[model samples]
Target: MNRSAAPLVRELQPGEIGPAAAGLVLDALAARRDPVIGVATGSSPSPLYAALSASGADFSRAAWFALDEYVGLPAGHPQSYAEVLRREIIEPLGLDPQAVHLPDPHREDLQKACDEYERSIAAAGGIDLQILGIGRNGHLAFNEPGGALDSRTRVEILTEDTRRANQRFFDSLDSVPTRCLTQGLGTILDAGQLLLIARGQDKAEALRAALRGPVSPECPASVLQLHGRLTVLADPAAASLL
Candidate 1:
């Protein structure tokens, strides 16, 4: 497969990015009878999710899968990725809650949980499209720097940078979970298409590293360069370096 092409990068006005992303989702939804959509949770994707919900689009036939989950949070914790996506995308869009899947971090056999998540993705016919966000440190999902490029669904130790970035969602930095179950870079690349959203000046350097820097484990998002179909939406601030 030809995976060396650079992603299509569109720098939109801050307010225009969300609606354009929603339009892409609508196109994907119409093309597939039962689309499996992989979604990321973070500030970058919040606007797209909000736009999708507000557009009154029908997501009932779509199966939503979270890219990762915190390892120790309770089932209903407000900060849990499952709950975050539920509140941000599922409930607002009136999706069937049962159709939304999250990696089960509560399982004692965490590896088994990861394996099951992979199997579940396979059974759902793989992800038709994946929505993604890059961390300030260049991590994708929870797959931190130095993870294997061909890694599978598995648990990963959170880097201090990641924890510090996520601290805003928790009561304090100490409350942030230090580990998570995340889909590997390989798993993310398996999706038929990828849509990466980035905003703000804080993401500029990471976005530069991801879209233009070398493809290596040091910048997990750089793996996007190896995917056949990738689209990136960014504000001028985020795409400044590019």
Candidate 2:
């Protein structure tokens, strides 16, 4: 264990997600002239992204990276993580799409691409801030529980729970991707700071486990207890159990 304390849980009032997130972004930008940020997919971080997008934040010099991407989806697919990010965050912020890094699992040379992406992140001076969301099964990004906590960016078969939760992205539940490419625990730890965001009642148990449970792969987000600077942000529903 890294000897760091558990994440500081706080209850967010209605509509406070935006200001809270904007404050974090402002803090990051002020701390680093060109911050390297890691972004996650799904509905949890949407409010935060929206707030940052409208903050008039100048990201021209900043570099952005995603936590994961579906393996079989085309880059242009509406459900693709890349597309979701572009539609919700990158485009709205007027960021150079070229500067935004997304894992291209569609490539046959996925291993090579993963290595290259890691190299690019390292070369850009590692991440100053990494935003995150917890899955129903306590997964972070696509680093699902039962998998090795020390793992790195690579392909993974999505768990059934994950698929069910994300089924809306597809025409039918069957259309949801079975696999993904996600940054490893090592990659997430390389960041100087990390922010894990959550909301809703569905996240309560997972949030409680992450806060009170042991550091085990059974609850992957528990790994944050080892990081030096990790901030867990959650709304009242998500904070209920905590």
Candidate 3:
């Protein structure tokens, strides 16, 4: 695939990010008869979700797909990506639970579960737009550093840095799952459009690398530049390095 020179990067105020992102979603909804949205869970996307919730938009026809989920968590675990999406996206937007899809992390046959997730996405006609949040270490979804660029939906081992960053969502650091099922770089890039959001100074370096550095697995998000249609939204602090 021919890589774009760079993604369209826009640095805006913290408050401005939400409405700006909402505009994009609203435009997409107006254009597509059936919209498939790829959802990301993290602080960076919280504002966008809030904006959508308040926009009085009708999302009944949309289908939501989570980007990743923690492995070995009991069903309905509060911190699971399923619950997070429920609390953040589904309930607030009044979306049907049946319209939202998440990978089954509790399955005994995880590889089959992953394959099924991929097939489900394909059956839905692939994602129209994918919302993304960058890890401090530049990981996309759970496709951590050192993962293959052409990877698909599968299991991935969490890096210590990633685990540490996510420990706040769990009772303790040890409670954070070491493994996750995630849509890999190849899977995410399949979307018709990609929208990445980042915030805070902690993300400055990662955002810089993803936007300006070489497309290397060491900074998984750098793969975004290889995408034909990608837009990055970041707060001034997060975009400082760029």
Global lDDT of each model?
Answer: 0.92, 0.84, 0.93
lDDT of 2 by residue, 1-242 (tens): 45485566667874887679778877887888778888887888888878888788677888899999988876588998888888988888898998889877878888887888788888989989999899988998898888888888888788999999999778998899998889988788778888888888999999888778888899988888888787888889998887
| Residue pairs clashing, model 2 | none
Q: Kindly list the per-residue Cα lDDT of model 3 for residues 128-166, writing each as its tens digit.
A: 999999999999999999989988999999999999999
The count of backbone overlaps in candidate 2 is 0
Model 3, runs deviating above 4 Å = none
- The 10-residue segment of model 1 with minimum total lDDT is 1-10
* Candidate 2 residue spans exceeding 4 A from truth: none
Model 1's TM-score against the true structure: 0.98
Order of the predicted models by lDDT, top scorer first:
3, 1, 2
* Ranking, TM-score, top scorer first: 3, 1, 2
Q: List the residue pairs that clash in candidate 3.
A: none
Winner on lDDT (1 vs 3): 3
**lDDT for model 2, on a 0 to 1 scale?**
0.84
